[model samples]
Target: MASALNSKIHAPGNCPGSKADARGGAGWRMDCDPEMHVKMCKKIAQLTKVIYALNTRQDETEAGMEALREAHQEELQQAVAETEARLLQAQGRVGEEEALRQRIQALESALELQKQLTQEALAQSASCRLETQERELRVEAEHAERVLTLSKEMLELKADYEKRLRHLSGHEAPRWDRLTKEGPEPKAEPGCGPEMREVLLEVERLRAENQQLSKDYARKAEELQATYERENEAVRQAMQQSVSEALWQWQEKETDLRKNFQAQEAALQAQVRKLEGDLEHRGRKISDLKKYAQKLKDRIQDLDVQLKEARQENSELKSTAKKLGEKLAIAKDKLMLQECHVTQKTGDMKTERVSENEVLRKENNLEACSLHPQQDQNFAKECPCTKGGTDTQTKKEACIETEYMKQKYEEDLRKIKHQTEEEKKHLKDQLMKRLEDLVKKHTVEIKSVRSSVEAERKRLQKEVEAQLEEVKKKSENEIKQLEEEKAALSVKLQNSLLEVLRLEEFIQQNKACPPRGDEKPQELDYQHCNILETQ
Candidate 1:
């Protein structure tokens, strides 16, 4: 019987009584005993159960693998999101740095412009001062020239008067000698006495006029010199005051500009340092995020490896089940042959065979109940056949136990798949939320930074405008003062010219009328002399 069973199990498809041929024949019929038919039906039922369990296990494993794939996809998405966020942050920091650099350049340009303006103003002031000084010196030189000319004319007039006086004295002595020799004869001439008296009166008057003229010329010259000196002193004082005030104003402006430049430079340096620090901090954060992403990638790789292994195991189980199915088909063919033989021998043994099958089924149920679920599956795999049992019974029991194991495996796989799906969903949601929050926070920070920069720029502009206004006011005041000083100097110059003209007119009038000794001097000439003496 064992040899027959072996031949049936290993039979080729082309053999006449082979399992394949039996299943293929359209008119094939079994003339089998009832007890043997029952046993074969039980084996068929067990094989079907095993196939159903394997299909269920395969579905569960596929589901579990799908869950693992989703989880890996979610991890990859999260990594991509984090990388994009880091890139955005880096770009923002770079933009901020560029803006700061532009602002610094603008400030530097403004400072340079201010310096140029200050320099131009100083040059204008200096030129104006030099021009004023030159004008004053010219006026002084003119006054000195007028004074010297007047002094030379006065000296020439004094020498002429002295020579005329000596001539008059010599002629008078000769006339007196002649009058003594011919006194009686001269008494006989008409009007001689009266004429002599008149001559004497005129000489006395001329002498008095000459003395008065000398005194008036000396006094006028002294007055002219005094006025010229006083004017020069006043002009000198004004020039000194203007120079001193200009120096003081220029000093004050320089000091203020220096202080402002230093303050602006310090502020710019601080802002640059702050921006650099922020860049460094951002770089560190990006590096840390990159490391975290790498770790996630490694974990995803491990999950992929596990999923491949699970798929490979599921395929192996399917192949083993296929082999078991082929064995069960061969066993069914052998059981059919044995049933035909028993039926030919007798029909009276039917009740006994049915009772025996029932008792064997009951014992199988009891054994299954007594074993733990895991142990039952392990026992079935390790010991498919018992020493006292027939080969068909052993195979049938092994198929049933294998089906139970497959069912358990499917249940475990289904549970694992459910858990993995939940975890994947939860992780995806968390990563998305975190990314959203980070984006919002970065946006808010960028807005605040922009506002601060604008405010600082406005403040700097206001300060520069105010300083320019102050400098303009000061320059205007200085120009006004200089103009006033120039006007005063012009007025003084006009007055000095008028005084010099008056002195020249007086000297010319004295030269036009001179006193005579022979004829009596006119009364008008005497009055003019008296007026000149008083002046």
Candidate 2:
């Protein structure tokens, strides 16, 4: 505004010379001291020169201020651009993290799928093993049945041999007496029957022992099957522990990835904050320039009024000089009072212009002073000339614009913060859901496996118990047959002993009557060998 103040003096059309000459002729010159007029002219000349210098200085100051304002505005635009770029970069990073999260989720899903497949495969394998074991048990049971049939055949054969022996014992006594009484000694080994009986008994005992061994082998096979089940349980536990460990490691890796993403986001936020600070300072500078321009416009208008008054005064001075030429020395005394009035008017105009300039300068300074606190700190550092460059309302507008931008940026930051939090929560929820699914799947699989294992164990145990009962029944039947055969053998030995004792007593009674030895031998001598029941 100060730079615009040029040629702004107002003068009235009634000048000192013109007014003095109008009332009296040369009295205009006679009343005013000639020396004072010359002094005033010299003063005006010096003051004009000073005003020109001041205008030059003001122009330079204004130019410099304009350049500074433009530079600050450019800086503000650059800062805003940088801030926007930073925000975009942060958004990019957030997008990248989201993508990574998606990929991680996909990976986790794939792993879960693989785990499920593996579990299914394991179950199938376990079923196959059970089938194989069942086949083995069936084969063992078949072998045991074959051995039992063989034992039964051997027992029937022993019973047949005992019946044949009893038939021979019943018929042999009459044949032995005839052979001894009618023939010269027909000597054949008489112990062949006993030898054959001993050999048959040994064969039956061997068959019984073989059947017992088969029973023992079947019992051992059942024990081995139980041991196999225990081993399978231990192996299954080992696999479960390893699977849990791997899942735990994956969770640790997931936590590490999340922490890294958060750290990068925090660094980006710091960069954004620095840019926002610089943008606010530049906005304040631009506002200052606007107010300065307004001040200059007002000053220019005031100068136009000053110019119009100056032109009218110059015309009046010319008219006064013409009137003074007409009324020379006669009006000098009256003109002195008119000269006094003109000087008073000139002084008043100059003083008023000076005061107005001072007031405008003060207002500009006050306006410039109304800067943001943050800008003021920087202005104190970089721009001392900021004081008197603009008006108060211009600074106020800057403050408002800065506040609005700050609020907008803060709101955006808040929105971004909210989105980030929500995304994190969403990701967490997804992770938790996946974890729950894994747990549920694992739990279900474990329960199914456990039930299957239990079912299989129970089925195998029942089969083994059934086999054991079958073997017991077979053993009891064999034992009963063996006891019956033992009792019959003991009865045959007792009958043979009683026949030998009776024969000995008869022989002793006949020994005292040895006279008829040559007479036909009685058949009774061979009777001892004729016991068919003993056979």
Identify the candidate with maximal TM-score. Answer: 1
In angstroms, the error of model 1 at 299 is 5.2
lDDT of 2: 0.46
TM-score list, all predictions:
0.45, 0.31
RMSD of each: 17.5, 34.8
Considering summed lDDT, which 10 consecutive residues are worst modelled in model 2?
1-10
Q: Write the per-residue lDDT of candidate 2 for residues 3-105, one digit (tens) a residue.
A: 2111111123434434433333223223433443344344345434544554555455556556655765675576568667756866775686577557646
Q: Which residue pairs in candidate 1 have backbone atoms (N, alpha carbon, C) closer than 3 angstroms, thus clashing?
A: none
Instruction: Provide the clash count, candidate 1.
Output: 0
Instruction: List the candidate 2 regions with Cα displacement exceeding 4 Å.
Output: 1-39, 53-65, 173-535
**Candidate 1, overall lDDT?**
0.57
- Tens digits of per-residue lDDT, candidate 1, 1-535, equal 3335434433444233434334422112233223333444555565567667878888888898898889888988888897888789778878987898798678768767866766665675567566655656565556645554554555556556767677776767676677778774676447577767765786887778787766666566556645755665566556556655665665566566656655665675566456546645654564466457546654765676567667765775576567555655654554444433332222223334446556755765787898778866765564434422443543354355445544654464466458646855775686567557755765675566556655655665566557556645654664465456445544544454454445445444544543233111232234334434433
Candidate 1 local Cα displacement, residue 18, angstroms: 20
Cα lDDT, model 2, residue 519: 25
